[model samples]
Target: MSATTPSKLEKMLKAGHQAVTSECGPPRGSDAEAIKEKARMIKDHVDAINITDNQTSVTRLCSLAACIHLKLAGLDPILQMVTRDRNRIAIQSDILGAASFDIHNILCLSGDHQSFGDCAAGQNVHDLDSMQLIQTVRHMRDEGKFLGGEDIKRPPSMFVGAAANPFADPYEIRVPRLAKKVAAGVEFIQTQCIFNLDKFERWMGEARDRGLLEKVYILAGLTPLKSAGMAKYMKNRVPGMDVPDEVVARIAGVPKEKQAEEGIKMCIEAIQRLKEVPGVAGFHVMAIEWEEKVPEIVEGGGLYPRPKLD
Candidate 1:
């Protein structure tokens, strides 16, 4: 659904400026204050904030609730909805709920498997995969109809986005997969957190060759390493994660107390280099739960003093 109210994200990208966005993981417990606290940390620095829906399959406060919290705090929020937890009915209900509040930016995902999260016994509900979910949102918005061909009144005006993984296997399929998302009507793409620039550059080149550079806005994901141990964990433990060996060594070489500082430096470096990539549209700096570090990353990357949009 298109937001009747202006979206800073859509405006920034359309105006040809690189947009900056970040993710905020909602608290597992019922804590409205937690969401507000995180909002205060990065509200001034990012064009929009993405509130994750049960990320990593772990149960948390629903993304819609968190988005409302951010919106009430005067922040633009991207409501991240995963198909794993909800069926088409719940999804559409959430879309309507978010839109009524003018929370239009939504990121659709298939979600991490429940097995990986707190509820291993819980069954998944992937009634619509990521691609289908994207199409569903687009359908509801553009056609003014539900998935069942029923008309919808005042359909939410959503700025649609989907995730991409340049670091995923069978690199040949990465660009093709992205093309599918674009064809499904995604307006923006926030790629997997990138630590391997060479591989990301190659992916960008392929995306450009496919002429997708103009089809959608691409936001490269950058996460600061809070510690060398975290780097090593992401390198070895996280699926689809591609932390270069040298990067691990670089952070590991630093003293334990200073590794976080080094990680921020690395993130800023990634943003600078990505700016030169032809298809890059912006940066999605995911500082994880460490939201306080975002301002420094935005500032260090020379994205400070965010645009004063109306």
Candidate 2:
């Protein structure tokens, strides 16, 4: 979309500043107060809070509702939409709904498979993949038209974003895939959690060679290894996540009581190293359920005092 008045996240990226974004998940039950409490803790520490839409295929409160709650609470939220849950009709309708509540930033994703979530028998409705989803949002925002050629008088003014995995298999095609997303009109990208910096940098080099960095903002994904068990879970069970052996050893070397501290230290180091990478714009720090630790990590990583927008 041609942004008329940029969202805070868009303004920071366009200013060439190192932006910081974090995730805030909705609760399983209808406890809006709990969600608001979590957002209040880190609202000042991040450029925008990402409202996840039933992430990992687990059912939760709708992302649009949570985003509107966050918006009313005075926090800028990026409404995340997954293709697995809704068809294009619902997707576009929710996009308009989110905009009506003043939510401007959106991240389109092909969500996690249902088999991994609590319900294995749940049938997914991936009516549109990430590419088509990106195009759909652009049409609504820029063209002011629905997918079926209908027109909107005042369409949603949104800054579109998508997720990427530099560590995924057949690594040779990863950068080109990213180029394809950029070609599809994604204004920004947030990668899967990065533990293998060498591989991530290599992917960044490839993206730089293709000039994808110039076309879109790239926010390196980061998550601290909370424990040795957590590391093993990511390495063995999680898809599109690459936790290096050295990282495992670093966490394992610490005592059980101190593992979390060591993990945060490693995250801080990763942020410092990524700052020097050519195509890296900023970090999307996802502490998962450990939301309270975000402020410490952001301040420790030296990304605090997020750019002020006029």
The CA lDDT of each predicted structure is 0.91, 0.90
Error of 2 at 290 (Å): 0.6
Give the poorly placed runs of model 2, Cα more than 4 Å off: 1-5
lDDT tens readout by residue for model 1, 1-310: 2333367798888778889999999998998899889989899999999999999999999999999988988889999999998999999998999999999799989888898999999989998999999999999999999998999999888889999999999887999999999999998999999999999999999999999988899999999999989999999999999999999999999999999999999999999888988879999989998999999999999888887654
Q: Distance (Å) between predicted and true CA of 61, model 1?
A: 0.7
Best by lDDT: 1
TM-scores for all candidates: the values are 0.97, 0.97
Error of 2 at 240 (Å): 1.3
Query: How would you encode candidate 2's per-residue C-alpha lDDT over 32-141 as one tens digit per residue?
Result: 98789889889888989899988887888888889999999878899999999899989999998988888989999999999877887988998999999999999898
**What residue runs in model 1 are displaced by over 4 Å at the alpha carbon?**
1-5
- Each prediction's total of clashing residue pairs, residues at least 3 apart in sequence or on different chains, is 5, 0
Tell how far residue 247 is off in model 2, in angstroms.
Answer: 0.6
lDDT of residue 74 for candidate 1: 86
